[model samples]
Target: MAELTTLARPYAKAVFDAAKDQDAIDLWDQALAFAAQVAANEQVKVILAKPGLAEQRKAQLLADCFEEQLPEALSNFLSILAENNRLALLPAISELFSLYRADLERTVKMQVSTAFEMTAEQQQKLIDALSRKLERKVELESSVDQSLIGGVVIRTGDLVIDASVRGKLAKMANAVGS
Candidate 1:
C-alpha cells in the first residue's frame, strides 16, 4: 500500500498542480475519481494488462469510458500514465489528489470509531471541537465497532487518538508485559 502511494505521489502532485493553475480542482477531482473507478474494474484491468495493446489505445479507451469529454490536459495526463504503464496507480493517485485538495481548502477528513453509534449532536460537537483545535474544517466519517468496547477512537491523517476501553486494556497489558 505504501509503495503504491509512493509511486502515485508524483503523478498526483503534478495533476493537483495543473488543476490548481487552471482553477479546475473540483473538475479534476471528479475526473480522477471516475478514472480510478474505471481503472479498478476487473474487465478494464484485464484489457489494460494485455502486453500487445498499444499505449495510445489504452489511453484512448480510458478517455472514451468517461461520459463527459475530458479536458485536454487530463487526456494528456492519461496518455502519460498509459505510456508509463501506471494506470493501476489511478486509485492511489485519486486518493492523494483528494488529500491535496483538502489541504488546499483547509479541510480535514476524520474517521471516528466507537463501540456505539454517535448521535448527531455528538458528531457535531466533535466536529466543532476539532475545527477549533485544528483551525480547519472537519469532515467526520463515523462507524460503530463493537470490538472497541467503549469510548471512541478518532483518526485524521497521521494522527490517531485512541480513547477506547479496548485500547486502554491493550496499553496496560503491554506495559505490564514490557
Candidate 2:
C-alpha cells in the first residue's frame, strides 16, 4: 500500500495542479474518482493487466466506460497511466487527489461514532464546535456504534477524540493500574 501510494503521488500531484490551473478542481476530482472506480472493477483489472494489450487500447477501454466523453486533459492522463502500466494505481491516485483538494479547500472530513443516532441539532452543534476549533470547514460522517456505550468518538485524519463511556473506563482502568 505504501509503495503504491508513493508511486501514485506524482501522478496525483500533476493532475491536481492541472485541475487547479484550469479552475476545474472539483470536476477533475469527480472524474478521477469515477475512473478509479472503473479501474477497480475485476473485469477491468484483468483487461488492464493483459500484457499483449496496447496502451492506447487500455486507455480507450476506460474512456468508453464513461457515459459522457472525458475532458481531453483527463483522457491524456489516463493514456499516460496506461502507457506506464500504472492503471492499478488509480485508487491511490484518486485518494491522494482528494487529500490535496481537501488541503487546498481548507476542509476536513471527520467520522463520528456514537452509541445512538445523532439528532440533526446535535450533529450541527458538533460540526459548529469542530469548525471553530479546527478553523476549517468540517464535513461529518456519523454512524451509530452501540459498543461505544455512550457519548462519541470523533476521528479526522491522525486526530481522535474519544469521549465514549467505554473509552473513559479504559483510561480510568489504566490510571488505577499504574
RMSD each, Å = 1.3, 1.4
Give the C-alpha miss distance for residue 5 in model 1, angstroms.
2.0
Instruction: Please provide, for model 2 over 82-171, each residue's C-alpha lDDT reduced to its tens digit, 9 standing for 90 to 100.
Output: 889898899999999999999999999999999999999999999999999989999999999999999999998789999999999999
Q: What lDDT score is found at residue 36 in candidate 1? A: 95
Worst 10 residues of 2 by lDDT: 79-88
Clashes of each: 0, 0
Against the reference, the lDDT scores of all candidates come to: 0.95, 0.95
TM-score of 1: 0.94
How far residue 102's Cα lies from its native spot in candidate 1, in Å, is 0.5
Assess the local accuracy of residue 176 in candidate 2 as a C-alpha lDDT between 0 and 100. 100
Q: Provide the lowest-lDDT 10-residue window in model 1.
A: 65-74
